[model samples]
Target chain A: MDYGEADRILTLLTREMGRISARAPGARRSQKRFAGRLDRFALVAVRLSGPPHRLTLLEAELEEPFLGLRDRLESSAAAAYVVEVSAALSPEGEAQPRIFGLVLEALAHLAEADGPPSPDLLRAFELKALDAAGLMPALDACAACGGPLAGEGIGFSPAGGGAVCPDHAAADPAASPLSPADVHHLRALARAPLGEPRADVGRAAHRRQASALRTFLDAQLGRRPRSAAFLEQVMET
Target chain B: MAEADPIRRLIHQLSRLPGVGEKTATRLAFHLLRADRAICLDLARALEEVSAQVGLCGRCANLAAIDPCPTCRDERRTDDTICVVERPQDQWALERAPEYRGRFHVLHGALDPLSGIGPEQLQIASLLHRLAPAAVREVILATNPTVEGEATALYLARLLKPLGVKVTRIAQGVALGSEIEYADQGTLSRALAHRHDFG
Candidate 1:
């Protein structure tokens, strides 16, 4: 959002600082300090000044502007979703290098990915992000009753934080049905490397997992991420 | 807060404007109180008339007193070329040069995912609609050289290229009168990367 005159208050997620807000004075009017480095998903190195509570952006060197992702609505939206998720999951002032690296890797893939951003890319990132945040949804067995999944069909319980057996699922209003194929795909997405051909579960399945993962994530976060709307619009259009 | 209601209300409203602090707002209110009644009335009327009379152009989306605006209605401007800008102010800045004879398209903003300004939020659909009817051959993207602006331009280029229209971006470099030593590394590097052939 626009701030006083040319200044911008930037919220950034980083390896050193999990999430931080810094004032970029004159960023909007002058191309000298921040210019292209301040946009979403741009990797930058910055010089900071001022006290710990009120850091100011002194200078920024753009590492990668992710210009490729900016070229298409779908790609940009997909990238935005991951960026929002990354920021939300990471707590401020606590360093988590793994999460930071994961975000950078995901963004780089989004920028270089050859088509309209693959839904699987986002799914994969979300899975890893959840794991990094120590919120990985239980998929190995039923989240309730401590029992292994018995059939080809199962139900996902967002509140339960994983898959639930049929008995519990029937009783739990929050449980949504998931096919064995979806379970397989979700497992693959949680651990598989991005762009792995093995993770190609077809577009319809991809869309299903995307919706499910998003719903589950929202439930976990207790608030719908802002980029979810943009992602939906981009995919729908 | 002021002791009087009118003065307090004026300061409150004035402070809502960008960059106007409480001190500045109070100072402006005091100044206005001492000014001639004619000046205050004229300022009020201008504000009212601007809101009532000024509207965005249907074609270019520029804020104007009439639909289509003078720029869109001008026959002398070529239909084959269109210069796209992030805001109406940018179009005016470009117009200061007077060398380009093409019409304009104002996006009102750039692609900023953080702030939720995307393709649908801008005047992109209108720009695309104008292209075919006008037989547009080339598009000059004059969006600011900022990150969002470049991204918006690239996004537009990708969208417009399949239509067989040529897409180009405005050149970014050191200002004409600026010294090389004063230019930032980003600008200098870009200038070197996008250097043009000289006679």
Candidate 2:
């Protein structure tokens, strides 16, 4: 959005900068200056000046406009969801090469998706983001009891940080019921490489995985990512 | 002390406005102090009246003093063609040309998901409401030619196309009198994409 008449405040997540907000004056009206390079979700290389607390964008070179995601609603929504999550996970003024790479890769997949980007793509990003943020829960074992989570009727507890066996699940108040399929999907999401194609899961199972990850991510962040609501709406359709 | 206190308060308030740094605010404050007392009082009254009286138009969501703004109520305007803008300022920009003689719908903002602004946050529902009763045949999306603006236009196109109404995007091209060499690549590309045949 525009901060002043001609200037704009851009929130960008960069590999070296982590998350930064820079001011680009005359970005809105000046065709020769930034030259439409400051659009959202477009990867660009920028030269910045000013103090560490406040940076002014001096120049920008458009590297990837990601035009495919910009035109489609579902793809745009997916990009938004991933960007929001990346912003939430990244701390300002710190370099996070892994998270940045994750976001760039996810956005690439989203741009190319014939339909809405696979829920697996977002889930994988989330799981990796949690790891990068040092919040990777014990997916293999019970989060609370540290026991094996090896059976049907398991539950995933966001409050406790991961899946729990029925024993600890019964004790945890915030545990959401997870079917065997949901657990398998979550594990695959955490383990699969970016753009990995696994067997297609049922819609019900997909929704369950998304809901569980959303809850877990919200618990870690202390608030649901605002983009998650729109992402949910887009995915529902 | 009383006079100094008021002056200090004025500078503080003025500095809060966008683009008004403390130095500029102080300069404005001193200027106002040196100017006629009537000017200061008149400025204060104008601000108060604007806040007290001005409100959004019920139909178009544009800032106005009346329930339905004059533009909304203007019988001369055609309901069949509605120009959609992201903000009231954008609507004014289009009206400056004086060529578009249609009613306006202000979205108040664009569909920026990263900022948590979605269809619900904007005046999309009200737009649909306006379309339901009105003889709206064409919706001219005059949103700024930015990424968010394009996404917003595309989103609206998808939403409004189903209603069987014609949705059109304003043509983007090099500004009049500007050299083609100075035009940005994106603008030039779009201009070429939407090129028209010469008479």
Top lDDT: which candidate number? Answer: 2
TM-score of chain A of each: 0.93, 0.94
- Categorize the docking of model 2: acceptable
Task: Estimate the TM-score for candidate 2.
Answer: 0.88
Query: What is the C-alpha local distance difference test score of each model?
Result: 0.81, 0.84
Backbone clashes in model 2, listed as residue pairs: none
Q: Cα RMSDs of all predictions?
A: 3.3, 3.1
TM-score, cand. 1 vs. native: 0.85
- What tens digits encode model 2's per-residue C-alpha lDDT throughout B1-199? 3335888989888877876667878999999999999999999999999999999999999999898999999998888999999999998888888778999999999988777888888999989998897499999998888767877887899889989899998988888998897665566767887799998
